[model samples]
Target: MKKTMLIIVLSVFALGCKPKQTVANTKLDNKTERLMKGDWLVSSVKYVGSDVFKVTSFNIADAKCFEESMWTLVSNNNTGEVVLNKANCATFESKITWYVNKDGNFVMKFLSEGIKAKHTTSGYVLKVANQTETSFQLIDKAAVGSNTAEIVFQFDKIGN
Candidate 1:
């Protein structure tokens, strides 16, 4: 009888001590790291909504300045940087921090004024519509002045 009671207690203790699932187990933390750790080219940029309309499809070839521009993402520390070579538009580069939040949304944090004086502030959360090793799509719906705009950024792998 004593041996049977001891076995029962041991089983209960073992069940209570089971390991919990970590952020790594969710797969996003690891996947985000794997997919973003490289240099990407801005393949396409699109905007729509009250603030902006769907203009003609544009790519690096259409914009000469943009051709030299590149986006580098370092997933190990959730940091990123963008080099804006559009001198005709602006002459600025930006350092950014990024992460996948609890809600599974991608968040960007700017340490300074950033690439665009009007566009670069904290709390820009982008949704990952689609992603793969060769390509990635991020959508950001944000308020610009009194109007709202939906911006889509499509990137293609260029190098590591």
Candidate 2:
């Protein structure tokens, strides 16, 4: 009886630990990816919430610094680069891999020099909103004392 009970417990535990599977919305992903491939500029960064709330975007610099940053998205390989060259802020550039997930989440992983994106265990996810041929926004949420706030990155296409 004891051996049977132990076996049953282990079986249940194994089943419960199985990973969940999610279906990819390939149609949406492909469409968004195609639309996003090109040069873009971070035209503005806005915070929507209490005026006292402060947030750092992507753990890089203040949200304001992201304004005027240039982004190049190459859809063929899902690779890109971001160039932050705003005045009064440290200049920065990074290679990034990005994709649009099934749920319309924009997933991105920044690759440092000599580091492969697959080896990195973490990345950022933001909801894609108001996407168009000329403009789009990436909205990230932050916890603000039990309330949630939004950090919006507005991107405008730079050129053909």
| Predicted candidate 2 versus true structure: per-residue lDDT over 1-160, tens digit per residue | 9999999999999999999999544444878888999999999888885557777888888888999999999988999999999999988899999998768888898899999998987888899999999999999998777888998999999978
Off-target runs (Cα >4 Å) in candidate 1 are 1-28, 48-68, 113-121, 143-149
Off by over 4 Å in 2: 1-28
**C-alpha lDDT score of every prediction, in listed order:** 0.64, 0.89
Worst 10 residues of 1 by lDDT: 55-64
Which candidate achieves the best lDDT against the true structure?
Answer: 2
lDDT, candidate 1, 1-160, per-residue tens: 9999999999999999999865521224557656878898877666654323432212212233344467788888777887766556554466777776545567766556425433644446677767889888777664566876667778789954
Cα-based TM-score, every candidate: 0.59, 0.84
| Candidate 1 clash pair list | none
